[model samples]
Target: MRAVLFAFALLLAPSAPVLAQALPYHIDPGAREIVPSLAAVPSIRFLTTADFPPFNFRDDKGELVGFNVDLARALCADLAITCTVQAWPWDQAARALEDRQGDALIAGLALTPQNGALFDFSQIYLMLPGRFVTPVAAASGFEPASLDGKRVAVRRGSTHAEFIRRYLPTAGLIQFDSEIMALDALSKGEADAYFGDAMRASFWLNEHVGCCEFAGEPYFRPDLFGDGLAVAVPAGADAVRQVIDYGLARLKRSGAYDELYLRWFPVSFY
Candidate 1:
């Protein structure tokens, strides 16, 4: 939950934006139907870490509760199988799955070609794009060309920073040690804008009475953010992967994804 608080602290303006925020219906629109079948395994042991809030995190009761946890439960229900989500250090979770200590991994498992060789991943679920947060009156279009010559603040050495340097090189780059610092600089007019995690940027606007709003469209680089997070089934567990694919698609078509999304986000984090 510290990460959740940190997202809030980074964007401190605390006033609502003038724009009307809409439900993010564009999320995961590519889900396809899959016919589920019983896996050779009886139940799925889902490996996860509790540090990523809204995705997976421990509640005040120390219970594992969040979007990923609930989504796992929903997938299992759809598959008519039992699922046990276990938490560990984020670093160890992947090894635990590779060691065969867990049957699946579903805590923001980034899907990449290298990982694909080691594991079977379900379809994309959520993509966190880098976005620019700017003062409302200074709002710019959501495009790389729009950022040219603009002073952009970003966390030094972060994926967001790397993306800006690589893709939007013309933007005046201002590096900082922390996202909070970058955001503070943006609020104080030290920078023309802040570029970072879209969800956190959106939520930052949710809390602070808005001195600024997310500019342009959300930015994403597959090499940096991967092709979004997906459930990771053990290598060669084709049946299990198929079941996951089917279950997730069902959830998307049945509106379960939206329900779970709202339950966790509460505020618009688009």
Candidate 2:
């Protein structure tokens, strides 16, 4: 009875605003997307791993939960179809998908050439943009050009470090062994700013309160950062791919995506 009441309440609640200004993902508001019929898709099996937190993982309750888990349910709900999500070990997920054990994989699988050959991918819904974090005092006058002669901390030998070497060549680059150490340098005022993956940095910002804040806009260089997160479907599953993409677009349009985004990512790295 309690479960039924809660479910009924959800049906009555309005979804979040469509294309909220703070949302990181964007879908064109003017475009008329004809969502394909999902009558043919009676149900879906979404495979993921119980490791990548906030994306997919077992919660303290030992239930499979995360942004991807909720998103998969949202996809099915949008189409009014049945769906089940299963968590597998990282090593065995690809093999299980290849064996037809699941219809889709939403485990942040990289859209690589090798994976592309093995599976079709839905449209990218999330991007791991690079960002800068500076001590609050230094954040006000921050600019990419002003980074020249500034001490910027980055993880040693990382792609982010390489990005700074190529683009912000004039900045004095200081490399640390890990993101924690780099952020620590910024907190200690040893570095003017820290540059690295925004999502990862957001976690740090959440934990270390009042020490630093994000500066400058997020940077998306897919060529350097690699392609962003997308759903992986079985190879030759064009119908499945279309349906997944359509559901994603619909979520963005209806503001359900915004609701989920805000719930999972409180810091709003973008």
Candidate 3:
């Protein structure tokens, strides 16, 4: 499929030069810190699912590699603690954590109320916001408010579609079955702009090169888009959560987080 190939291409692409100036920092380096009052963490067991490429997946060499795996290593290094990241089927990952087989879940698990009952989540590290992409020529002039009669492409029944229905009601809504379909419509000029997950849009923009570019500010309605990605630790694991948060903040302060972001996402979404 075109989307799959695009993702593979993105993974193979050389790491781009650091875009920290343009990229937004998810964690504030200068924020007041609450030193976790806990015994030393000698080791950590991080559980993840491999099906989610770019986050956690097996490489052609059959070795575990991806942003999440690398991030786990970085976190461990930051704390000077030993850690093991293990992959399991998507369905089994949460259960493994529930069974005390892992210390934390690093995969992008949805932070829903149901899951909240079973786990405590770390501060969000990444948000998948909605963004608009238009033909390069139209990108400069594109404005969310000015799209009186313009067509906007989005995946049918997706949160992005609902966002358009509620917020940008004036624009004509064009729905597709998938993000790729919506992007394809935009590429052919069948739609004036395409609005969808910013991360996915970034990949398409990267693969298509000059076909299109991002326009306007990104929309981050967490209530509609779902809570951002966070590490999930078992219930009552406040100490573990605090430790992860400390490590994450340190990563942000040290610029290691930005380096990993650029290496994994050569095309900056923000």
Candidate 4:
């Protein structure tokens, strides 16, 4: 009987390490380890541009609403921190993080190597592949190579611009400050097609531009696009990065992230 009990104990010992690794990290709700300050520090300010809808935008009441805002709220709730949404121009918002004007940039901005050198990025939380959106009246059955000699409208400093320059260099690229402006250019017949994230392009097409249709398949340039959207923090903010990363990992694990994605973007991503 003693030999039998010893054998049973030996069998259970090997499983202990596996269980330990599966244990979730215990995070303090109201601590800087997971947020910024322990006691009532200013609410973490989220810098974003309200021009982009379905990602980040100002509602009729001047309230910030969209996927990024919802995600930020969830992260704040998990961290036991309060968040203040601030609307700034996209270029200014990027600069704000570098100038330390805000705690983080939650604008659903893509993570690129050029931006990485200026700011530290959290783990990518979502993926948005670019697509070509053109007027229905334009020649149908458009392909990537078919964009040759066509005028393409793209937002300045966007992956779409980078994509055109690299893959469709012969195409005339019209740069705009915001996605809305690009869509306007497409509507006004100033450009033959507008290239941008499929989700954003869909939103614009459905709500603003009725004559445009998505062309071909979604084009993904891993090198130019990097990963999905991540919160940008001031360089050297290791603590902030750690907290954001932990909260993001937890959100992904808790199934809350998918719910938020579905809430904002009803269309299938992949």
TM-score (all chains, Cα) for each model = 0.81, 0.88, 0.91, 0.56
User: Which sections of candidate 3 miss by over 4 Å?
Assistant: 1-12, 18-21, 28-32, 37-39
lDDT of candidate 2 over 59-79, digit per residue (tens): 558898777899999989988
Assess the local accuracy of residue 5 in candidate 2 as a C-alpha lDDT between 0 and 100.
23
- Per-candidate Cα RMSD to the true structure, in Å, reads 4.0, 7.4, 2.6, 17.5
* Model number with the top lDDT: 3
Lowest lDDT sum, 10 consecutive residues, model 3, at 1-10
Candidate order by decreasing TM-score? 3, 2, 1, 4
Sorted by lDDT, highest first, which candidate order results? 3, 2, 1, 4
Tell me the whole-model lDDT of each prediction, alpha carbons only: 0.74, 0.80, 0.83, 0.69
For candidate 3, what is the TM-score? Answer: 0.91
Residue pairs that clash (backbone atoms under 3 angstroms), model 3? none
Model 1 TM-score relative to the real fold: 0.81
Clashes of 3: 0
Can you write out model 4's per-residue Cα lDDT over 19-88, one digit (the tens) per residue? 1111212223333335434254335787887766656766668787777888888987877778777889
Q: Best TM-score goes to which candidate?
A: 3
Clashing pairs for model 1 are 13-208, 14-207, 14-208, 14-209, 15-208, 15-209, 15-210, 142-216, 142-217
Give the residue spans of candidate 1 off by over 4 A.
1-32, 39-42, 112-114, 140-146, 266-270
Judged by TM-score relative to the true structure, which candidate is superior, 3 or 4?
3
- The local distance difference test score of model 4 is 0.69
Residue lDDT tens for model 1, 109-139: 7676787788887766777677788887777
